[model samples]
Target chain A: MFSITGLLTISGILFVAGAAALITRRNAVAALMGVELMLNAANLNFVAGWRYFWPERLDAHVAVLLVITVAAAEAAVGLAIILNLYRKFGTVDLEQIRLMRG
Target chain B: MTHAQLTALLPVILLAGTAVALLLVQAITRSHRVTAGVTLAGLAAALVAVTRALPQGATPVTALLTIDRFALLYTGLLALIGIGLTLLSFLYLAGRTRLTGAYYILFTLALAGGAVLASSAHFAAFFLGLEMISVSLFALAAYRRDDPAGIEAGMKYLVLAGVATAVLLFGAALLYARYGTMAFAALGTAIAPGAGDPLTLAGIALVVAGIGFKLTLAPFHLWAPDVYEGAPAPVTGFIATISKAAVFALLLRLFTQVHLREHPALFAIFATLAIASIFAGNLLGLRQMNLKRVLAYSSVANMGYLLIAFLAGGPAGAIAATFYLTAYLPALLGIFTLLTALSGRERDADAIADYAGLAWRRPVLAAAFTVLLLSLAGIPLTGGFIGKFYVALTGVSAALAGSPAFWALVGALVVGSVIGLYYYLRIVLAFFQRTPAGEEPAAITRRVPDAAAIVLTLSTLAVLWLGVLPGNTLTLISLLVEEWFR
Candidate 1:
């Protein structure tokens, strides 16, 4: 098994990069991709946690399944919105769709 | 066979059975009125089930939910709130829209989902119930399929909710890795002493972030304003009251069971988020003109207050949070329903100036608005005030016991309450503000009011009832929570 420090270092790096991509990406779809990456990085940590902590229960597997299912749902819905955004304003740039700014 | 178990399962079965039956009925008859009528009946039946189970409450349903007076009471509140929205929905869709039966289908599904969420126990059930509610909300928010805004809002919700679910799953995964179990009770064995590793802590942090999005705590609350402004008023009402309260119930349950006081880091993160949300929500709301957007921001702050209850911790925290949710549902749903009626043909009711001299023009409707506004502002003789009082007392007392984080929470709640008053009172003020003597009587083709809504407009009545008779509600809540904790 890899050292805890190694596991943590990888997770930390993945998290920062994912968050950066999510924030900086102009395309809503790209931003969504960034979010998915972030969730995956966290999943890595979750599995690592299962190995190190509750090796017997492995409940983390259940959580992983839930994340995957929800991610799919998010993709379907987000893409639908993106399609609508294109139809209406003709662009997917987050900054451009500010008409409904409250 | 236990009374608590039976009672706890009552609403779940009733709601699930009803939703399925309605879906089937829609397939067979395709009548809008019948679908809505059946949904209303199902919710009423669930309410009856809860009342019946109250006396012998506090039963654990598969260790996923605690069936006590608390869950029953919350279920009853959801039932009542659903009644108003359902009443308004049928009339509105029948009058203007074409998807009559489907509207009630989504509406009842959302209500059932909310009820299940508030009463959920284990993480599996909790997450499932929340998704069930949220997915329905997405469809309802965009029920006006022809309207681009409706469709857009639903998409945003679906996407963001997707992210949140991911975060929560990560968090839960971490917990499972550390403890080898997904049950809330099983958490202690993993973390109390030996399991309190960095992985466990990190897992909890992820879960916090995930739930935070749902709570619409600032920073993560990007979609709320747009979603609120874009969706139909009744759907917004559903989002604000039923959806928001259900999440709080989930939080309270999770924290209470997890022994939140044991996690200082989690508490600190919650404190930071709460303070940020309170200020951001209030400050941002100041510039908003759209009535729905304003309410959405208000929800962000209102959630911040509920977090204060969590910061308080223990039975007092539980009691205060529950009370606030009870008051919040009616007031929010009432305001949205009122906005719906005032919107006339168009769906947009954004400007503060739209409601000039409403008190003079529509006295009864204005009276209901006044009650909702007063309760929201925590003014005297309203449930909002009492709920605020409980939260404030609990927060301050907890802070005195050396929780500096809770002290910050108390500070945030006080300031936010003051700032929140301006916007709510602004709306109320317009009700009395006369239109410069003869100014074109502010032409508005109001949506025809529903008679069934009058039975549910207990928004005004709740304010007076809870405000004047707070002790009874408080006593019952205390008893309910006391039993739940036991």
Candidate 2:
């Protein structure tokens, strides 16, 4: 039986992995993917919470749906921004785009 | 929804409608003047709506939003600032860009997001509102596509803010799993004082981290200076004022409901963040030559100071924070208006040297800039002084009320202010210093736009008025905060 603790443990691992990827990755697109993974981990937690803990209440389900919608919107805007960065710097490397450091 | 609920939501709805209308207007005709005028009218209408709805009293429009006097006060304040920004942006964008209409639409949408944040009572509303603001800002930050620095700033903000949002969501999911509800009121009731469930504590910590990122509190403030330096002057102002203020409003509401004062561990966490932000901001600010980066650090320190009042915890603390925010907004916006007016075709005039001999070139602008800077530094005869005074008063009272920890925060406030003063005065001194022979002042290459001049004059007047006669505003805030607690 899939337990709430098991679900939370998986989500926790996913979150840490995503955070690690974000910190280590230099490519802008790869970093974006890391963010997506983190968001999806949160989504999974919401769905699992709904199924295992509170099937009567739809709050978790609603939260999951809204999170997905916002994540999609964020990804779209993020990719467009990355594309713009590429056009300007001719590469999407975060390290190479350091033009305004103090 | 009932009529009362609908009326209570009028201001946010009006802002969203205006954004949609602007989209249609852009499709038909792309006149910058017309677009800006429409935006100004919409903002004014929303401000009026907020004022009109205030008398109806606190209305919980569903579980998602609570349109109380506190929310109305901030919503109205945001709309007023939105109007000022629209006017300044019109001048800032007039000859600089071809697609100015889209800028106003994004601007209006961001304002809508801020309004929602000010009134949100549930996690879902909070998440949605936060994203609305972030998504709009990501686009707005990169609006100047030709500028590589702007694009980089946008990309950095996107990646960082995206992660922050996800962290916040995971936290919310944890809370929901624990309590089966995401409503602030419900969560507040569910989590008892001194409760130490590991899951709940982790969730709360993650949530704080997410918000700390937005507020640019220390340890989470890495992106602020670079983004502020790269974004357009006006957009940077939007980030400083509306974005920070709205999120802070939500933070205050959420934490107060959760009785943060009763949770010693959580209280200590916030206190640490506050102290770290103050020292980090001030020490880092002292070394920055770029004016924008200096202002960014100043903002970080200012938010830290504001958190002192928030940590004080009571009606008095709430009132002090609101008053301090009121006093801060004009000073920040006025400075950016000046920056926007000084920017030329090539790039923003953000270097400290750009202001050399401004007193000799434009005496009135220089004087206004000095007043705004003095206000920021909490010098006497400016609103910032009174705001700082109230915050210090709250901190002292909290210290006396058995929380000696507040003494440390109050001490940081004092030291931070002293360090803050040097940089603020350094900027002011630059305004008076003579330019070397054969080297022209770079800030005045463009004629000051009339709209920008008006905004500067108004901001200066507002700051001075708050400083000289703050009794009425203070009383008003106290009453609203008292109502909020009830």
Pick the DockQ winner.
2
lDDT of 2 by residue, B350-460 (tens): 988899888888888889999999999999889999999999999999999989999999999999999999999899888888777668666755588788889989999
Find the candidate with the highest TM-score and give its number: 2
Q: In candidate 1, residue B474 scores what lDDT?
A: 82
Note the B-chain TM-score for every model.
Answer: 0.94, 0.99
State residue A39's C-alpha deviation in candidate 1, in Å: 4.5
DockQ scores for all predicted structures = 0.46, 0.87
Give all candidates' CA lDDT scores: 0.76, 0.90
lDDT of 1 by residue, B1-486 (tens): 665576668887888888888878977887777887898898889888878877774677776676666677777888888888787676657656766776776677677777777777677777777777777777777677567778767757765676677678667765765566777766754467323577678788888888899889998999889988888878888888888777787788777777767776777788888899999999899878777888889889989888888778788889898888878777887777677666655555556778778788777777888888889888888999999999999998987888766777888888899999998888888878867656623423353365535733666687778888988888888887886566
> Each candidate: RMSD to true structure?
3.0, 1.0
Error of 2 at A33 (Å): 0.8
